[model samples]
Target chain A: MIPAEGFFWSWILPALIFGVSLWATVALYRRFSR
Target chain B: MIRFGSIDIFWTSLFLLLMVGGAFWFYRLARRSESDFFLAGRGLPWWLPASSVFSTHTATDTPMWITGVIYKDGLRGLWYTFFSAWTAIGAFVAARIFRRSLAYTQAEWQSLRFSGLGAELLRGWMAGWQVFMNMFILGWVGIAMGKVGELVFGWPVWVGLIVPSLITAIYTLAAGYWGVVMGDFLQGIVAVFAILLVSLVGVVAAGGPGEITGKLVELGQEWRLDPFAFTGVSDGDFPMLWWLTMLVIAVVGGFGMGTSIDWYVEAQRIQSAKTVRDATYGLWAGGAITLIRNAFWAVSILAFFVMLPDIKDTAVSELGWFRLGFELLPMGLIGVFFGAILAIHLSTISSHLNLGALYFTRDLYQRYLNPEASEQKLVVVGRWTTAVLLIGSFFYGMMMEEITQWLIFALWLMSAGIWLPNILQVVWWRFNAWGYLAAWMANLGVSWLVVWILPGFNLLPELPDHIQFWLLMALGACFFLPATFLTKPEPMDRLVQYYVMTRPLGWWGPVHREAVRRGLIEETKKESGPVTRSMGIRRSWTPEAAQEWTREDWIAILLSPLVYTGLLFGLVQVLLMQMEGFALLGAAVIGTLIIYWVIDPKLKAVSEEFEAGQARFLDEVEARSRWEEA
Candidate 1:
């Protein structure tokens, strides 16, 4: 018996990771430029 | 005096039975021979090594420590540690770059690069240094884990460290790499599941993340990013200067250490790869896994902060937090969570033992004494060394003495002054025989002198030890590089052919064709043998391999990390929360099954590519060595 409402939309939780991912992706892309 | 009732007894019993039994089962699968004992025949797929590396390192103490740091600092601290995962990936680069070099150990690579007694002496000294260093690290690791055991089982210091270390040592000695890997793999699953399960229970026990975040958020804005942000402490924690110095030393000195040199976890994967590529990918996969796995610990710490804000004596202390978690978790999952924690503890201890033993056998005894020892003898020696190191670690844990009050300083000295100089030579071509050997002797001399003398000085402002170490290394490098060049130029023929055969990415000469025409081999290969180019002296290799973003592999590499992050996120977010109770359980099962199904095939293909690349790299190395002789 627990709440399962908004684990999907936990913006704060994902924010840090998402930012790092975006940065890593962009940097890698800019460098690789195939 | 403290006493535990039947319930407490049951918890310890359950943990011991699961991990020790699992370890025994893994040991049963061990094959005879050096490769089997050390590398598991390099046949395990990506998921296993990926999981094991993180799991083995994330021991009983690690979760509690994260919780303690986060409870004190919040999310930023947790996220900061995840960056080490990035450092670990550098090893993946190392594995891909140097994994399949025909040399058996990182030291062996040095030997191949050097000539005559200069090589042999350098090899022995490096081996000795590693053995000396592991003695400290292994003991510290043991003590850290033992502190957790004390909290869990109400065991005393003697029992806590000795018992666990003994069990890990005995099991590892019997099992070898195959046993360690299987144990670690099983341990990883249990550890993550346990942490996740306890975290859920902790969240339920302490409201939820929303409520928890509200408390943490209210702690002033500065607290969010850096714990020391609002402390008004101008110096910061160790100050900006110190932090920058440590970071530079870490990144720069790390280049010299080479793959399978420092981190035991990296070494395990490096040994087990079917080829260099497999090792590289496996390690990168390890990085990915570490990044994802840290989330569980972070979330759990968040839960702890919410549930027990003022974790005074009992909560913040290593054993104290687990006791708090035990109280929070509901009964059935408690057994499972304990199993996970135990898995984490045992796997970490075993990995440490294996690594410590590795330094003792490969670096010290074998390098110095038994160069012609059979594979079987080495394996036996590895096992015995593991046992001896375990005993030493247990005692060291017991008598964990005070180090030079500035731990960061000593660590820097070890890394920069000692390890960095050696690592630097591999990249810097001017790092010739005399210079390379001098780096070691110089570091030893300067460090020993500084420890005994400089600390007592009156005007000695608080300077970082690592920076000093870095300075010492730089000085050593410059001193050795020039002196050697003036003294002797590495017998021209050996140097030229050595350079030509390796096809390394960097070198000092564009004169190879002209030298070839004129029979000037020295000019053909101005600087000889294997070395790194980026951080070392300037040089470029023939047929320069464009390692990063090979157009064909880029898609797979880029897609892999994304897919992995996505899949993990989806499972944790979507399905785990799609429903509750049995539905949540079903979702985890289904998600794991699906993710594994997709990832296993992809990992296989990546491993095959890496293995092929590594084999070729090895062939090139051997050819280069022979060509130098020619």
Candidate 2:
């Protein structure tokens, strides 16, 4: 099994990138819709 | 072959049902009109098309291609993928200009940008070429799916090519781009999740990051870890000169539309956006995510390399990422992974189907065959065209025995010779339709001679790909530049109208003055006074002021490449736990923040001003399509 740091870099970091992108899209939609 | 369990079947079925059912739900909206079918009614918010951009670009072949390069050249191979970075500057520059033009297709934009017989011929040529290109893309991508199916279930290649494409065609035929963009949002999420999960599992399977790095040092391949590992300035497989050429192509090429073949697909997304700002942000954000996703794939491929360092065949090694997901993932999760693969495949298929149909319906059928075709008849023609393309792709896919060779040739054919002309069309007022048309005709013959004909005859040495690019570009310029000067410039009225509408940047001094003289727009003061008081950057912009090129736009264009480079190298290094990676990532973030700060206000002003006149411009576009105006 990978250590916690390795796991974070390999998985969590990319997950964060995706999550943030999706969130920003939502926010942009709200801003523009208004 | 791997066996599928009940849970695996359930997950796979669930994804398919959701994608097809959800897309079919948009039938009513897509059937509304030609615009609604082709462009989602030109009312999509930034995120909707943004997601579509990400998902549609992430084809089944993408991982295989990325894995092949990363496995061969290590981190340095990522430069091959960086060509997508055109969007970094393009979002601010070309995307804005294109959104203002409000043309439904780039082929249609040709006529709008130029006038008379030359413009008409160029538009016709571009429309037909786009139809062929889109069908070609569908074939290659479909064959990639066929290969995957063969590996997984022992199916014949044709079964793999035809089945999923026919399923994807269902939604495309039913709902057009409405189905495409909506379906893409869901697929984008699933695809991203799968890439992260499988990559994480692969890294763990390589005995973790610590072992992988230590093993690389033991094997004397530590250079693979360096993103800038150039073999030499002019020699070897990965040369410094090649890297520089790629950087120039990726960054500077952004100033022009259609510099990359990908630009044709992006044109649709840019028009689908509701406003100029939405289009800009959508394109930039989508491209950002694509690069970040590449970084993740790079790290995972590195892990694959460490685990199996002795794999000699590139074909076998190219399956590295898929092998990680299939061979390493747990049973139930394997199904989810396969579902994501299907998502990637279907998204690409659906997009090209609709896009090809758009070119056929709007540019060919509606424009030439029946100018007065009703909206309902056009949508029906679109559906019929979608079906025809699906059938055509099967023939192309079956005939294509070698994917990599054809893919490389096609990319070179599209990019190298036409690169300069693509930019000149956007920037130079003198580059009329005849000149652009001549460039396309010349590029075809020149590229053939430089890439294959002369080299095969042993008259020319087999030069490196970068050298070929430069040679092809130089020779192409010799033909097209003369053709441009020999022909008269586009008529003053046509030039003035294009100038006032799109407000294109660079070398448009005469047109700008004419627009001002005619009172089509106001001339701005030099504004060394109160207007220029803020932070040495002009923050406030009137619509007229924003129409002119400014220092802020230049700053964003120059810094954009640095951001892409930083994110690409930084993420890979960070995954390897390197300290410098963190620093580079920080620099990239700062660069992005600065770009947004400097440019957003001007973009907003320009978008607001342009949108106010959009309805009138749109009606004019409709008139041109019907040949009601010359």
Candidate 3:
């Protein structure tokens, strides 16, 4: 079995996710309005 | 390292109070009316359902299960993660096209969509299989929760196993969806917060995310980023192809399974929006946040594996959760997070426990046993079903030595089992009842014959793994559509009428008199059929669906929830991001206020547009489409 590798950077993804969600919310809402 | 600690009186009191209080608060809404019990009286705005979608999907052992995979593989689990993105996105797609589809459960939708021998066969298999699959899935969730309980509080294995299930059944039986949904909303919030807290604390505890990475690099374990980085130990254990194969199954073919209503919390969120516009906004935004949350757990586990390799691999039993909690959180926070786990587990247990009973009452008992049963009687049967099934669910988990495997299998089976007949029939014009029947039979056969036999073969070679069975069933189901379509097409009048009301752009043929007549035709006219309404869905699905739903009140509902979710997400991002530009801040503030203004007006304008469909929705939801409909 390949040894499991350990690394940490899950935090940034959530932040990035927060960003993408906002962008999506704004965009989808705008499309809905128009 | 993470700290395992005791829950003081404050937390102990808080946990009990929240568990008891939250359950009651939710059930109180159910008392307002049976509709309230089953459908939250359709009073809640989009945000609650949207948020609960994430919460509902975030099960007790989900983090550990997914994390366990990452611990074993590297970023390869992203195959599961990315394809799974289609869950919300596909739901959003469905929401836009079929916003009012929530009026019935998934099986009822199948029954309504098909007719003759095929329809009967399809519905029967669906109703039965729905129960079997739901019970199995609910069992894992029950086990995971109990396991967590045993690990955390040092409770007896049996007590830990039984308590949450019993407590959840009580609330779900009393409040029905109202109890589950209301409780889920809060639990979902706790889950997101708990995830955030754990990640932040884990990072700080590990001396920052950067430090965690540095430590990992020093340990010679920094090669996890190359999604395909693996030293092949087994032939088909996993190559790059494994990731690619999973991506196709999970992402591409996943849309087929998107229509199942087992987790109708998300569907209700979309359905209960002030307007189709507002509802989709909540779902879209909520879905977006949820996807991010999934990624958070995904990456955090990467840090975890690097941070504490000695933490050791553990099963999804009580001992495993106990060790994980202590190693992952600080003192008071551990108590707080453990409480969150209870909330998560209870939300699932109550939802499934009640839903499982719902299937028994609606699909089997009412349809098969008592056709004339009143809603009041069904309600009683449903409660009893919940009670009995929940007790059974507790033991279901205990039977599994490696509960997580069963849990994962349950999920895959649930997804693949219904994936074939659900989406393809709804969205694809070529799909038919015969195909759905075939798909279900193949799924049932494979699930029983192949999955049942995986354990014996795993110790040796030559036997297909359980997951491979899932892939085969999903593929076979999807492929069934094209094969059946070539041989036969149901007449336009019978099933097509249902399609006409639900889909405007999707029905085939040119956009003239022929198309109008074709669109207007139902199943009754199939003997003298016009041309097929082929092509694909039109661009204006959301607005068009709303137009059929509400004549003049379209713009308001469409705009308001959008504004509501917009303001909320926009405000959240601005506060969290704090970027340098005045443009950014102005855009955030302006966008939010605009959305807020739209919510009230749209809600007021379209208040009564939904009245007629409400009864039908109740019929399907409370009767034909109950929880097992998923």
Chain A only: list TM-scores of all candidates.
0.58, 0.68, 0.58
Best by lDDT: 2
Give the range of the ten consecutive residues with the poorest summed lDDT in model 3 chain B.
B531-540
lDDT of 3 by residue, B529-597 (tens): 232222321222222233333322233334333333333334322322324323444554575454344
| Best first by TM-score, ranked | 2, 1, 3
Q: Rank the candidates by DockQ, best first.
A: 2, 3, 1
Chain B superposition TM-score per model: 0.75, 0.98, 0.75
| Winner on lDDT (2 vs 3) | 2
Off by over 4 Å in 3: A1-34, B1-7, B32-34, B226-238, B257-275, B310-330, B402-421, B446-488, B504-515, B518-630
Candidate 1 C-alpha lDDT tens digits along B25-118? 4454453665566666666655656666776667666666665665566544543343343333344334543453445455655666666677
Tell me how far the alpha carbon of residue B580 in candidate 2 is from the true structure, in angstroms, after superposition. 1.4
Cα lDDT, model 2, residue B260: 86
lDDT of 3 at B310: 61
What are the fnat scores of the candidates, in the order listed? 0.00, 0.00, 0.00
Kindly give the stretch of ten consecutive residues in candidate 1 chain B with the minimal lDDT sum. Answer: B542-551
